[model samples]
Target: MTTEERDQLRRALSVYVEGAPTAPEWQDWNFQRAVPDRQHRFVTGPVVALVAAASLVLVVLGGITLLLRGNIPEVVGEPVTTMTVAPSVTATTEMSLPTGPVNPAAYADVPSFQGTVRYFQHDPALGSPGWQATVSVRFAEPMRFMYTVVEERPGDDDFLFLGGAGTTFIGDGTQIWLDEADDLPPLQTQQPGFFRHLFYDSESPSPAWNEICGASPERIGVETIAGRHTSHIACSTTLEDYELWIDEESGVVLKMRGPLFVGDLHPQVDRDGGFEFTEFAIAGVSIPEVKIPQVEIAGFFPPFHMVQEIDFGGGSVDTVEYWYRDESTWRESIIASSAPSAVGSFQLVADGQVGQCILEEDLCSVVPLEGDRLLFGLQLPSPTSRVPLEFVGDHCDQLAEETILGRAAFHFACDGVRFEIRGTWVALTDPTVGRSDYWYDKGTGLAVKYTGEGWSWDTQLLELEPVFDDAIFVHQEVEEQASEPWPDTYVAADGIVPAWSGPLLDGTTLDLDDFRTLPGSEPGSGGSFVVVYDWFPTCGPICLDGITDFQKLYDKYGTTDWSVTGGPNIEFVSVVDDDVSVAQRTNERLGITVPTVACFADEIDPAKGHNGLCTPDSPWSFWSIGVPSWTVIDTDGFLVYGVTGRDYDFAELDSLLADISGLTES
Candidate 1:
């Protein structure tokens, strides 16, 4: 039969089978009782046999339908009756049930409890030494109250200094705003608040279950925590391994110990040493009233006044004074100073203009704020109540409940970002480069403690007092003088490249003069052109492709006998900002035979390292934001062409080479 006819037949058979009376219904039929005993037996016996045969036919037909639909994989010489229907059903059953020693469902219903949670990390390499935050959370019905006092331990501080105070909600309920504190403008996007149900309802599996659970969760026996008996569950993922201790009777998570994932691109978290949470105690719910400061400004009351100390790296510190006049309109004054001297000061009136002044130079400038410069130092972005859980949902795995900083939290890994459930606070470390950690109050979402890689600031929570003084937003009056425009410090394209020397992979020191000179002429030759490639060993595929392209160019011009004798020889060299070992590995991987130089002996020190003709002050910095930069120095040692990032435009390079070679030939 045709496929359509077979489908129609299958549908008709299904309808007939569904409409047929069951054995019990058949027995209850009036006709069977009405008939004489001898005749009834004869009739019922054949009818029952026919019914059973028809049911068998329906089952066979259903199997055939599934096979035609490709739901069942076809096999040669295999009876259709032997094939199992819905193979996924078996696979799912395997995944959900424990093949190992632990029954995860046993401890799934953790009783709801409220308490304070403290989570902290210490790494001497991070410079700040150690940082931690403690927040009080009350786990109850309509809303969970979260309140925390922000504190910071600066490089000079022997003890934690009070930074600020704020509050947050952990459930689907209206915020209890203090009569004195006015609500700030809502963020552009609604942030996902902490779900208290995750703690109270243990039946709902944690987000990281599949990732951490693996084939099965192993029960590590019972342990006492916070004076309660708890069942320990051991779990692991490809990233890190951790343990979760759930209360034996209550099922509430008591503690969790694991390493946090760090970095966005090249993620590296300390595997051996990680963050730990303990001393979880049940505490009474008490949310202190938060007072918002009111600042008087131009017939309007600015309800927020924030004093932030920002370390702009490189030993420069900027003390920023912020006064929010509504949402869009605000005033920011940044007093930047380095060790031994005050570098400069800038006051940004985000509504219209920006005024800047250099202290020692007696230089001042006022520029119109527009486009990209409009938000210059006004650190106002739509505030988030908590980190957006959806953004990291796909990367999240192996979730376990634990008490952090005295509050119930679900510890999980998202991509490389680790979460120790509390407020929307994040401590990020890019071990590939540097580390930056910030603590924001769950309620206010204001940063309390901030420690950057090079420059760091720890803000102690001062009193949240009213700003009666309007003069705080007003610019200080200086001696009346015309403002001078700020001069650009970066080198422009076509600027002369400063001479520098570094040893190449071939064990020969090459300087800019070496490339500037013609093949058989003196150093002042005006026809030679140099190509310097600036790249990093860890720059991935694009860098390798660029290296291959450069190698081809070198083979075509540098190695060609006629090309060298015919015109000015083009010189090609690569300067990598990595160790010799890394450079060597990359060279071997890419099959690169070109002369490569390691800028630093052991590490990537941008200040002291020789990265081609490109330095921190080079205009190339504007284009080469990340790696794989290329610079072409003309015969006169002037930068003729400079481009950042990998370019697949071999035709452009070829055309430039042809034009330069033509000039030499002429």
Candidate 2:
């Protein structure tokens, strides 16, 4: 190979093979902390967020969004006053279930209130210091609220994000409307109301709702909270116990204490933390007009082209190429397969227009950017810490300036910040909210460095000149190979199989009923495992990598360890559809001693690209969904798991292997 070819090969080898961040380090990918996905492209590389392809946006929150969750419709408006919940507070202490049901929905349409509240979350047993905050809050009719954080106290954790503190956020259901302020965070102008997540079905909601709630509050009594006559109620659930002090007249909850969880996403966890009103009263809230923070990015922005290198700590690395044409236009491309041409790729880029598509299988989704919600779609991330600092509600602590990669960069850090993805709610933030140290290039305001737990990456400036080509800012069309994956044909087994047969390379016809089973499994599910590797060397470097891996795996055959305490059962098979002769030749060439199977194009079935293991009349198709795919089957002809990617999901495969190992342990 020429030097150029060798360089390309080396880059493709190092760049595209490992996409996810390593475990216990950058393992909690920041995807969950962002909005849900529109059309997520399965990445085959590292935590490098690339948007050159139209699939998913790797938001600063951690990972990509694969699923979406809609907000629960609020039962507000009209101020329904049919609430007749008059409970006699005869019992002064803890008691059993109350005869009078204390329904929270009954108070849902009650008078709105405004007051100062205090809340906290802590669990010494959870092995980390917790958080506490004090904020003044006000809500007027449907979707008008002014939430101002008075204080944020995070204990013992440098990465502790005091969410939305120090800034009075005014929202009329969506977008930040904070008044004009100098040097404040940018207007997280899109989907700003995501902080108010509704996780329960309203009609019969969980008693844990922070709104006019529902759910059975186990016990009822009377107490005064915030100087209001209240019915102090307590609840008991399988997880923990909680209490609430509701207004006797209005049905509004005056105070509440319980385990903190919003439809399952709970952070600073393992303990119940709650908030209560120090003072509250019925009042009409006046919505204020707040201005988006103006970040100083004139000379600092348009930092041009740069490449970010992410070290996965396991001798593997990936790079994120940035093409920042200007402030409003930029692209993040993580060359999953190969770059410059960007095949087998996943990236983020969009035209200045609103949108184009939202199909999950499509390579691109131009999610509508209504206003200035650039970061919402994994657009260009600003060099200013204001945006992230606002998300975490931290007062930007300007750290000492640092030199990174021979460039002077502004240094700052946030405990954590949840990036917003509008209308997509697969999951919430908190899974990967680690202390993140950020460094911005002083001259360009480009994020030069981002370091978190156990892992770190650097953005080295390649060029600082303006990208003159307007075509570079234009989004690329979806390619055939880079689109969504092939349909998953793997199915669960029912512990039974037909007497189907296929030709093995040893000139033997192996029937489903002919294999031996593991010791503890059912008698005749065609017993021994047929670990099938679905690839041949003709499939390029991907297939070559698979063949090499298959060789290592095939080595386990006939060994004491392979038998797992000497049961003498599991089998390994390599499937090649080229031809029986081709299979033999490839196997010999690759030194693949494992028994090979020839699944040549069957005349009975229409020709397809990959006609794997020709059990033509069998229920288990066992076909290669994608070249370099692999599947596991029991002695029975049933699919245990199937991985259809350029690279195997080794962690998932390891888990399946362990499960089988446990089954054969006896």
Number of clashing residue pairs in every model?
A: 23, 33
What TM-score, computed on C-alpha atoms, does each candidate reach? 0.34, 0.42
TM-score of 2: 0.42
Off by over 4 Å in 2: 1-110, 120-133, 141-143, 149-173, 176-219, 234-240, 248-251, 262-273, 285-288, 293-316, 320-331, 336-350, 354-364, 371-666
Which candidate number would show the highest lDDT if scored against the true structure?
2
**Candidate 1 total steric clashes:** 23
Name the lDDT of candidate 1.
0.40
Steric clash count of candidate 2: 33
After TM-score superposition, the amount by which residue 546's alpha carbon in candidate 2 deviates from its true location, in angstroms, is 30
lDDT per residue as tens, model 2, 1-666? 111222222221121111221211111111111112211111111111111122122232111122211122221232322212223445344334345656443333655567666655542223332565566666664446666656655553322222334444556554443321222222232322222421121222233243333345544556656666666655543323456666655555566655443211112221234556666766666665433332223233544677677654433345656666554556655543211122323333445542222221223445555345343433333222223322222433578888877778777765544332222111123445667677776675666676776557777555787555666556556554423232233242343333345678788776656565645777543356667776644334567777677667556442234455433356677766455555665676667787776766323244452344443334445233244568666655655655654547655564566556443423
